[model samples]
Target: MMVCIRRLFLLLGMIATPAIASPTISVLTDSLEHPWGLAFLPEGDVLVTERPGRLQRIELATGRQTIIPGTPTVSASGQGGLLDIALHPNFADNRWVYLTWAGHCETGTATHLGRGRLVGNALEDFETLFVATPCVDSGRHFGSRIVFDTNGYLFMTTGDRGERDRAQDLTDHNGAVLRLNDNGSIPSDNPFVDDPRGADAIYSYGHRNPQGVAIYPDTGALWIHEHGPRGGDEINLPVPGGNFGWPKVTYGREYWGPQIGEESIPGMVDPIYQWTPSIAPSGMAFYRGDLFVGALVQTHLAHLELNGETVTQETQLLSELNRRIRAIAQGPDNLLYLLTDQRNGELLRLSP
Candidate 1:
C-alpha cells in the first residue's frame, strides 16, 4: 500500500489516564461519500458501505475505488440507507458478505439483513434474509450494525424507528439485538425462540438508535452503545433476554424539555457507562494490541482503558482533525483505522 505518513502532534487531552500515544495519521483516500461501515477483505483490500446506497471496494495498495453492483434498493432518507457490512467467519471459504440496510417493507421501510457471494466486483446470488417488522414511514433511528461472536453466530441490532414505545414491545423486531445463524435463520437457542409473544430472533431488547455493536475479545460478550434523545448516550454489555430500559427509564430527557422516565428502574438494566450532554457516539472497538486501548468515537476518538468490565480511564485523541469519526476498526496489522462521516469522507489509518 502506498501510505503517506503525517505526524499529528496536537495537544493531548486526558480525562483520568496518562497521555495516549500520538500515532501518525495517514489518509488512505478522501473520496468516500459518507462511508458508514467497513470490513477488511482477506486479500488485504477493504469493503466500505456508503449511506447514500452504494457499496464500494478500496484497493489499499493503490487507493483505487470500484463500485460493487447489485446492492439492495435502499431508502436513502434522513438517517436510513445502506448501513453496516460484515463477512462470514469462514469468508475465505464461503465468500459470504452480509449487509444491513433500510429497505421498503409491506408496512413501510425497515432495517433488513441480506447476504451474497462476492465474485469479482459484484455480489452474486444476493438474497434478502431477514426483515424487521412493524416498519414505519419515518426515516430515523435505524439501529443496524452487524457483528459475529466467537460462537460463529451472527448478531444484528435494530432501532425503534422513531417510535419509542416499540422498544418495550417484545412482539416486534424493532429496538432489539437479534441473533441468527450465518445463513440468516433464527437460532433455536435464541432467548425468544420459544416465546410466542417475542420475535424468534431477538436476543435483547430496549434500545434507542444503537449504531454500534462489537464482540468483546476473549470474553465473547456483546458490547453495544446507543444514542438517547437529548442526552444519555450509553455503553452497555447486552446479555441474552436482557432489557435495557429506554423510555421507561433513561438518563436522557426529551428534546423539548421533560425527563423521559426514572433514571433507574427495578427490573430494567442500567448502562455500564453513560454520557450526559450526548457525545453522539457511533462506532466502537476494543484494541488488545500494543496500546491496549478501547476506541469509541464522537466528534473525537475516545480511548477508554478497560479493567475487565469497568472503564478505568479515558483519553480523547485526534480532536484536531475536526472530522466526525463514524466508525472504527482495528486492522489486521493491529493498527487503528477510522472513517469520517461527511459528504467528502476520508478513510484514515493510525500507526504507533
Candidate 2:
C-alpha cells in the first residue's frame, strides 16, 4: 500500500497545477537578534539560535520566548556565526541537542560541532564534540550544517574556506561531508579511513559551499544543496567515496568572468539537479505530507518541480520568499515549515 501511494505521487508531480497559492507569512517573533537556526521539540516548543550566540525556546501556542543558557561563544563575523541546530534522534529520552557554529582559533575561524542536554530552558553539560582542525583565517566559507543518519551517525558539511583548491585535497576535511559517531568519534567504517592521502573523517569530497542537508525519510538517502560560484547551484545525492566535482568541474562560471571548470571530467560525479542564476539554496527538506501531492512524489529533490522554462504551472517559492530560505521541516500535523534568513526573517507555514 505504501509503495502504491508513493508511485502515485511520482506521477502527479510530473503534471502541473492551475493556480499557485501565495503563502500566508506571519511574524512569529521579531527582534530575534539575528536568528540562524530552528528546531522543534516533541512537546510543541520551537528552539531558535541567534547568530551572536544565544539560544531561545518559543512556546508554539503562547508565543512566549525563553533564553537557553550555556551556549558556546561564536565568531559571528561575515557569514560566520551560530549556524545550525539539530535535535538528537532520540531527543525525547536523551534531551541532547547538537550545534554547529564558527569557532575562533589562533589562525582564524573554523566550523565546530558541540552537543548538550536541554533541560527546561537551559543547556546542561555542554561539550565541544568535534572541531575542524587547521583553521583558516578567512570567514568566507563556513559550510556548517548538521544532519543525523538512521545508522546513528552524525554527518556535517564543511566548506573549503574560500580556497578553491582545497575542494580536491583529500588531506583536508574542508569542502567535504564528514561522518562521525554521535559522541564525536570517527566511525571505523568511513570510506577514506585507510587511504593514505584521505582524511578518515571524510565521507565524500569535491564540494563547494554546501549549506543544506537532509535525509529522505522514505529512501533514507542523503540530499544536499550547495552554492555555486556565479550561477550553478546544485542538488546532489551524497554517497561515501563520491566526488561531487566543484572547482575542478562545474556547470557554473567563475564570479570574475567566463566559464571556469569543465563539466565533463573523468571520475567526477554529476549533480542530480542544477539551477542557473543561483537560488543560493539552503536548508532543504523532503516533504512527505498529504497537503501537497506533487511535493510528496518528488521526495528526493529540493523543489517541487524542475526549472521555470520546463514547467509553466510551477511556482518559484524560493524567489518569492525573497530572503534566503534557511531551513525546512515538517510539523507534527504534517504541514511544511520554512525558516527565512535575514535580520527580520520569518517562520512560514505551508499547507493545502
Candidate 3:
C-alpha cells in the first residue's frame, strides 16, 4: 500500500525521490571516414562501410579496426559511394557479405550490388550481381538499402537518380525495389516476372530515395522510409509492382516551391506515416531487449511503438548528443548500435 503512495508521489513530484537509472551511451569507435552502414557477425565482431569505398571489421570489446581488402573502387560523388551491407542470413554456413555501392559504368555512375566471402581480411570470390540499368552521371538518389526476408530472399531499394520521371517507367530499374536470391538470381514468382516489359528484377516502383528499410517485428511486413522533396517524408509498405506516386502524386512541393504531382492519384499507394520537416532517417533495427522500456523511451529518435500496422508512438533518444543518425541495429548482446555520418564518423553503443 505504501509502495503505491510512493509511486504516486514520484509521478506527481510531490516528494524528493531517488533518481532513476537511465540507459548508458558510449562511443565505441571514432575516426571512421563517413561511415554509412553497420552489421554484426555471429561472433560479435562488427562490419562497417565507409562511403569512401572501404569496409572494416571492428573488434567490439576493444574498438579496434582492420580494413577488409578487395573492395571495388566506387564513384564517390554527391550522394554516392559504398552504401549498405548485410550478412547472409545463414552466415554460419555462408561467409558471404553483400554490399551496395555507387560505381561508374560504361554509361555513367550507377548503383551496384555485389558480394564476396570475408576471407582473411579480404573479399575473396567477389562478383557483381546487378547494376542499375541506364546509369546517369549524377551521383544523387542512390535509393539503396538491403534487407533479407524470412524466405531467404534479398530486398533492395533503388533511387530515381534525380530522374523523377523514370520512377514511372516500368522498363527502368530506378525508384524500385529488387528481390533476388542470395546468388543474385531474380525469383520466378516476383510481381513482374511474367511481364517482359518490366525491369526483370523489379519488385515495386515509385520510390524517391529510401535509405532505411526493415522488417516489422510483429508482422513480417517489408517497410521502407524515403526522403521527400520539401515536407513529405514517408514510410511505406511497397507492394509488388505497385506505384507509390512519386512526381505524379506527392504531399511535398519542389525545392523552388511548386506542388508536385496530384496529391491522391487513384492507382498509387499512400504512405503509412510521414514527417513534415523530415527526420532524415537512415539505418534501422527492431528492438529486442528488455531495457529502457519502463523508464525512458528507446534511444535517439530511432525506436517506434506500434499497434498492429500503425505507429502509436514515436521518439528521438539521443538528439541531445547532436549526431546525424546513419544506422541503428540490435546487436547480438541485445543492445543498440549506431553510426553517425560525418567526415570523421563514429560508431556508438547503447546499453540499458
Candidate 4:
C-alpha cells in the first residue's frame, strides 16, 4: 500500500511540476537535406537517411558527412523516398543495416524493407527483404517506421497510402504494423498467422500515417504514434491483433472542417494520448539509457511520467526552438539528438 501511495504522490508531483528544465541545444550540423531517420552505429558514427534517395554517414567527432553508396532507386514522390533506417540487433556481428524506402511498384509505390552489409563506405550485397502489398499511386500516408524489440523481433509500420478503407482490410499490408524475424521470414506465432482473413505479418491494423514507434522501457511494450488529418494525432501502445481505428473513429476532421467518423467505437483501441490540434508528430524514442519513460513531442521534447503503462504526467520541453522536430534518438553518450525537417535540415544535439 505504501508503494502505491508513493507512486501516486510521485505522479502528482510530476503533474504539479510542469515546467521541466530545458536541455542545452546545439547544432551539430546544418548540411543535411530533409533528414528523415537516423541510427547510431556501434562505433559512434550516425547513419541518417535523407528523403530524396540518399543515405549519409556522419562522423560525430568532426561532423563530416559521407554519402554511403548502394541505396535502392526510390520513387521520391510526395511523401515517397528513403525513409527509416535501423541496425540489426546483432549488427556488430552481422554488419547488417536495414532500411525502409518508397520503391516503385506496378500501381505506383510501396514501402520496401531491405538490408545490406556495411563493408567499407558502401552497402554490399543489398537485397530487398519485404515489400508492402497492393501499392497505390497516392503520395500521402506512407508510415514506414522500423524498430527491433528486446527479443530481436523486427516491427515495421505502414500507412494506408491515403486510402482510408484499406486500413480496415486485413488482406493487404496497408495501415498495419508488421512483425518478422531478423531474416525477413514471418513468425509462426503472429496474430494472424495461418488466418486466411488477414495477412500473416500483420500484428496490428487501422493506423493513420504512424511515423514514430518505440519499445517501452523494462516492459518491452511497443508504443506508436500516428498523424491524423486536421487533428487527432495519437500515441498508442499496440498489442498483437489490435485494431486502432483511423477514419472510422477519430478525433479529427477533414482539412476543410468535416468530421471523419465517430469519436469512439465498440471494438477499436483508442489512443493513450492525443493531440487535438495536431502537433504533426514524426519520430520518437524513449529516454531508454537514462531510465526515463519520456519522448520528444512534435515541436517540443515531452517528458512523460508513466506509472506502469499509463502516462500520468507530461512535461513539454524545447518549445523555444520553434522548429519542426522530425526524428529524435538518444546517443551513446547519453545525449539526445534531433533532426529538424526542412529543405535545409539540421542535426541538433541536446544535453540535459
Best by TM-score: 1
lDDT of 3 by residue, 1-352 (tens): 0012122222222344356434456687878998988889888899999999999999999899999998888888798999999999987788899999999998888889999998767899889998888888688899799999888899999899998998889888888888888889989998889998798799989888888888876667788888788767778897888889897877778889888877777878998877665566677666641111100111244446666677777655565666777887778887667787888788877653
For residues 159-197, what per-residue lDDT tens digits would candidate 4 score against the true structure? 999999999999989899999998889999999997899
| lDDT of the candidates, in the order given | 0.83, 0.74, 0.79, 0.83
lDDT of model 1 at residue 253?
91
Clashes of 2: 0
Q: Which candidate do you rate higher for lDDT, 2 or 3? A: 3
Q: Using lDDT as the measure, name the better of candidate 3 and candidate 4.
A: 4
Per-candidate TM-scores read 0.92, 0.86, 0.90, 0.90
> Least lDDT summed over 10 consecutive residues: which range in candidate 1?
6-15
Q: Which is the leading candidate under lDDT?
A: 1
Candidate 1 C-alpha lDDT tens digits along 119-216: 99999999999998888888989888999999999999999999998999999889999998988898999998888888898998999889888888
Model 3 lDDT on a 0 to 1 scale = 0.79
Residue pairs in candidate 2 whose N, alpha carbon or C atoms collide under 3 angstroms: none
Model 4 misses residue 214 by how many Å?
Answer: 0.5
Candidate 1 residue pairs that clash: none
Instruction: Output the better candidate (1/4) by TM-score.
Output: 1
- Over 4 Å off, model 1: 1-22, 289-298
